[model samples]
Target: MTPRPAKGGRAPAMSTEQRREMIVRATIPLLIEQGSSVTTRRIAQAAGIGEGTVFRVFTDKEELLDACVAEAMDPGTSLAEIRSIPLDQPLAARLTQAAEALRAHVDRIGAVMGALHATEGRSRAAGRPGTKSPDRQAGMNAATDAIAGLFAPEEDSLRLPPRQLAQLFFGLLFTSSIQESPQDIGPVVDVFLHGALASTG
Candidate 1:
């Protein structure tokens, strides 16, 4: 019965980081489900927070949209690890690894692909050129560098520059429709890397 404690003296809670994390966690699936029009209210509902709280955290819709897009295309795979993949292994093995990696990248950000298609339509209507973002450009650069470093034979002696080869490979990865069979990608990549017609008699 001494000091009677300091009633209501406990410090106010600090949950800013937690709130932000929750918002980010909810953003991806919502974006996936609702396309890019995902409103602040929608995000708040997904995150289980008040609509006002979303605005308190994000300055505007554009800022939040940009953040969500960035997260979607992160490429989760590390550059070093990608470089370490056995590119020099037999062509079949290399192709398998490359196919799996490409699949993984798409799986992680597959939801964005639909949005990208819509964006492309708008850009084309406006006569704008569609291109990869700086981050994606850098990723392409790193991937090509890795390919050149590993499979020197692919373009080392070939007349085409490493960059051109990189472009071809990048296009193959990004543009080919998601075929049901993985084997389909292999020959497609081959036709891309090697000519469709073979010289063998």
Candidate 2:
């Protein structure tokens, strides 16, 4: 369940990580629906805390956004499921399952990259000189690495590199537009399993 601040204008004493996680989790929906336009006021309302509490927990709005990206990137919930993929399954079957899982993950964090991008459009966020923050890059790299681990067991039969395939698959997932999406992801998986080349015999 979503967390709410304690009653009587008092917040329960929460550790640093606890407060950060609560704020990030509360902000997740706002980020998805509103992108970078989400404000601390909205986050505060969602979190059931005073607006000042947000700054107390984070140095500034940029830091809050940074933490949100990190939270979104963490595979803690899904890592176990990915690792549990049955090795005996056919490569295609396994990959399709991976695709489905990845799709759900992408949907969960829809437009998160866009939010980060839009935020940076104003100016570079803390912790990096580039358009994207190091935290964002770290999160992305961690997600790709976890996905690659899923493909490792089947690497012996894969012509394309597992990690490369993981990266490409996620790239497609991330950039996919909701309105432009097909009726289902099956066709996308089909294309991934078999690309532009066709049988000419």
Best by lDDT: 2
* Stretch of 10 with least lDDT, candidate 2: 121-130
Clashes of each: 0, 0
lDDT of 1 at 193: 58
lDDT by residue for model 1 (1-201), tens: 113335687544436665655677787687666666667898888787789988887776555655566555665464455566765576545645665665666665666546545544111112223433537676667766665554554654666776666567667766877573566677776776567799797
Q: For candidate 2, write residues 112-134 as lDDT tens digits.
A: 76665665522223444432544
The local lDDT score (0 to 100) that residue 2 gets in candidate 2 is 32
Q: Pick the candidate with the highest TM-score.
A: 2
Deviation of model 1 at 35, angstroms:
2.0
Q: After superposition, which runs of candidate 1 have C-alpha atoms over 4 Å from their true positions?
A: 1-22, 37-53, 74-81, 84-89, 103-110, 113-136, 150-165, 171-181, 192-195, 198-201
Show model 2 residue runs off by greater than 4 Å.
Answer: 1-12, 73-80, 86-91, 104-110, 116-184, 188-201
